[model samples]
Target chain A: MSNKVTYTEIVEALSRKTGFSKSKSEEFIKGVIGLAKQDLDENGKAVITNFGSFTVKEVAERQGQNPQTGEPITIPAHKRVNFSAYKPLRERVNAPFAHLETELLEEESGTDEQESEVTPPPKEAEAKKEPVSPSSRKKDNDNSGLMIAALLLLVIVALASGWFLMTADEETPATDQAAIETPQTPEATETMDDVAMEENSEETNTEQVGQADSPQATEPQSDSLPENPETTEQRATGSVDTPETYQVESGEWYWVIAEKVYGESGFWPLLFQANETLEDDPDQLYPSMGLEVPELEGTVATPTSNDYQRLALASTMVSEAYQRAGKTEKAEEYARFAEKWERQSRQ
Target chain B: MTKADVIKQLAEELDLTQEETDQLYDSFVEGMITLLSNNRGFTLPGLGSFHAEVRTEHKSYNPHYQQMMKIPPKKVVHFKQSSVLRDELNEGEDEQ
Candidate 1:
């Protein structure tokens, strides 16, 4: 027998078991459901011995927000129908797993001591790796911090130098390459330089962020890093999968691409940063142009405040870029987008 | 409706004796229980479908007792209402 036994089949089975006509059995089944419905409607509850009970529950009205606009709204109250099976019927349904037993754990008095003892070995291992007096340890910390800052500074210098060289060429190809590299490098360094006086201070702030992120990040990276390339290959070839890049179609603009990718027209700046070939002229997108869609850790389906902050920063950069290019109207448009995202982030 | 109330109503509607109606109701409940216990689902055309689903076991911390309790996995019956029945029940709900 297949899993789903239909109504007629059940009636047929009922007739065979009860020595009643099929029509009579069907009528009985219909009558029971009708009565239960009436009972629930009138009394808000119905009880059937050895079967289950049905209840009509009133759900109170609650405050909510319109997801698109972030405007506060009221969710109207509603009625919900609920069913709970009787104990005998519940036990019958659970027959397959009846042998399983719940286990209550006894709390151990030494749990705190055990955790403290467990934590020391890892610290001891780290200490063994860098055995030093207090002064030497401080020196080592400074040296490591300097090393990171120096590396980041070198990367920024190299990218800036490359952009300058590309500008000197006065050709589209070099500019295209530079444009792709320019958006990320300049934006990152701009924020760092604006906020901090020294590279060493920037390094310390970055280290704090890294430390905060590492506990969750390290466990996934240990195994997933090896599989990343294969997954990217799959994504590139699989047309049915979630698209990682969008090919610009005829009549499409930055707002359309932004809408398609991030579900908001205001997020065009994020799209610009992903491609950056559109940096010089954001409106000159041609057909068959492939634009990368940067994979965000969390999608806008349920955006966090942190996501809004990042989007606001991107929008602000686009506004600043347009202002520098002497396009006041376009700059103002992006500035409005930045303001909207900033307000959302604050909320 | 209580089982006795249902039996009485069925007896009146179908022109059957109380004893016969009671027997028929028991037989129906027995059949449903047997089908569900065997991990098979049944659909009543205008009413609904009854299916058994297995819920996985998991450990939950009991903050009051300061200990973890492991809940064992088990199968449970779920009833989904037919659209026709749902609409009938929710009729004029939106107008309210």
Candidate 2:
């Protein structure tokens, strides 16, 4: 190990082996060196056959301190080069003595020269000699056995602790219930009693009243209705005087008018249903087209004036066009317009 | 093999004179050197590729003072044997 050989020596030996002249060998070596430099500078990599590659790497700029002055300095970013030895080079350099060991082993085992000499001793001999030293050997065996027993005892203790923890958790709910019952405030207790007394009084009063009023309540209901019959007829006749009317006006898209009146444009379909003479496609209506806003059955009457009628007619025409094209969403829009006109007329 | 032994063998095999064999050997060496000088690598058909490598500027440690140091990279030459040569040389050994 003390006698370190240089690369030159190896190259000289190679030249001798290959019958290359001294000058030629030097030139060849120089050529290889120059090429490697050029490759790194140009492409950032130099790939040598069977000898691995050299790569150029960039180092980022970083903060560094001057060792001498301990002053902070910015180390400017730079490129660096590195070499990685290939598999063959690594094998040759790392374990040169491997072959020697193989040779020695082969000689000892009486194997062919081609076979590697490095071999460990037979296992049987090593095993048989183990029990010879009784005191130390026995101590070693006892220590191992003690270790195993200690481990087993630890596992048992852990299991027992886990069981205790689980049972303790299960008892917590019962302990909580006992804690809850032990706390009682006088005011809270009084409030609960008051609520119970009030409920009892209300129930008793309701039962007494039900018994006293039942027959009389039934008799008054029939007598009161006839007295309001004339007034009900007058109210019904009053609605006919202010019948709802709708009128169409100029410059309005049916969809726009429908959307403004109804929250959704989809209510237009109901407008077509209200006016049987109008086409199902509501978009065909021109300006000034008239329509009757239909009353929503069983609801308060919505009055539609003449002007409102025309607007409702236009909205229905647009809605019907959308409906005929299988656009149910647009058809529902005009329906809302008629409803809006009816509401306004009633107002 | 020795140079003399190689020459004598070549003479015997090719029926050439010793002087002619020597000339042939010299030309081969010169040719290989020239090829490598121009291309930076030489590929012998059954041997392997021989190439030159360079180590560029890199940051390294100067252990003496426990400080970072810049080691200006240097160029070097290396030889690599081909697979064919490796197999032939290690013919009898078990690969594993």
Candidate 3:
């Protein structure tokens, strides 16, 4: 026999759930049905809420014939019944479909990888992101500052060494004669005269910058040991990466090339000095043109690269301090200097 | 089993006073009647549905009697077993 939950089973289950005696539960079940029947007898319908309806329907009887005799007979009218289940009951009857639907829903969600839908986190969740931007910017500034310092220190050392080398070349023929030799006397006089003229020009420029700023004044004496430490520091910092001579690419300007090599076009003046054969105009252009890029020299009595970086840092510091001190004009002046230094660094 | 047997078993199982179970039973009947009298429906979820429908007067020939006759209209109660109940009843059958 098939297992079925009959009216009796329902009563039993209800009794078990409601703590009712078996007889009483049976009485209750019968009472409810009895009332429904009474209502149906009096009225046309009865509703049991979520369960559905007990409907009374009518039927009309018509004429009928006896199949064997073919005799006509009158048929009496009668009543009929119909039922329609409500939502909950209907859903319960098709409960397995619900499980199928849930499975289909899950499958749809799995297959649709909706990466474009960006659900932002709550504001509190992203609080960490707010402070990060400023901190990252500050760190960037710190890195650029360090790079500037390293580059400046490199340029400074390069300058001091180049100056000392130039001075040594000036004095080499007279004192360091063992380090110099000529197979014949034909070019000796010419070379010595050439060296003398170079020294004279360099000395005149050094003196012209003013007695207070001369190379000799910067040190206790010009011919001293101050240049050695600078040269050692220069070698230690791996300045060999700086190319001494760059082949002039056709159609490229000197300023553009200087900017590429030294990160500043101001150093093109030094290029002119190194490539003495180049025209004074600095803009005369030709293909396959050769130019020399010399490092800075202390004897030039000009501001070194690091001197400029130090000046930049000082300008910004002064600007900020003055701004805090309520000196707007002074602050703006220093800020302009800082901006100029920044521009120079970008050159 | 009979409806009496069901109530008896239910009372025994629930341990409720006879009056309480009887009251519950009375209320259900009263509610169903009140709802149906107003042409509403009653559904015992997972059990089935019950309803009422009107039939109009008509004339028709009865196949058996082989005669034409006038028919009067009437109303009657109806019951339909829920799919779950039907499935339970016909558990071994292949189709619903």
Against the true structure, whose lDDT is highest? 1
The candidate maximizing DockQ is 1
Compute the lDDT for candidate 2: 0.41
TM-score of model 3 vs. true structure: 0.24
Comparing 2 and 3 on lDDT, the stronger one: 3
After the best TM-score superposition of candidate 1, give how far the Cα of residue A48 lies from its true spot, in angstroms. 1.9
Give one digit per residue, the lDDT tens place, for model 1 in A1-347: 12676787788767756788989898999888888777877888877678988887777888989999999988777676778999988975664345455444323432353344334344443353333223343554678766645655654455455544544454332112222334333333333333233445455553333122222333333344233333343444464323565655557887886776666676677776655431345665654344556655566575678778778877877786688668889889888988998998899
Error of 2 at A138 (Å): 26
The lDDT-based order of candidates, best leading, equals 1, 3, 2
Model 3 misplaced regions, further than 4 Å: A62-75, A98-347, B1-96
Sorted by DockQ (best first), the order is: 1, 3, 2
Candidate 3, residues A1-347: lDDT per residue as tens digits?
11223455455545544566767666656555544454555675655444456676655667988788999876555444456656544433322112111001111232232111211222332354335434544554678766644543443344345444554555532211212322211122222222233345343333232122222332422222233223333332334433554544456776676675666654453454344321223454343232345554321235555645544665665565556557788678767877786676455
Q: Which lDDT tens digits does candidate 2 get at residues A48-163?
A: 44445767665677899999999998876655555565654443332211111100111122233212211122233334333432333355466876664454344334434443
Candidate RMSDs in Å, in order, are 26.0, 44.4, 47.9
DockQ of each: 0.23, 0.01, 0.02
Q: Any residue pairs clashing in model 1, and if so which?
A: none
> Lowest-scoring 10 consecutive residues by lDDT in candidate 3 chain B?
B31-40
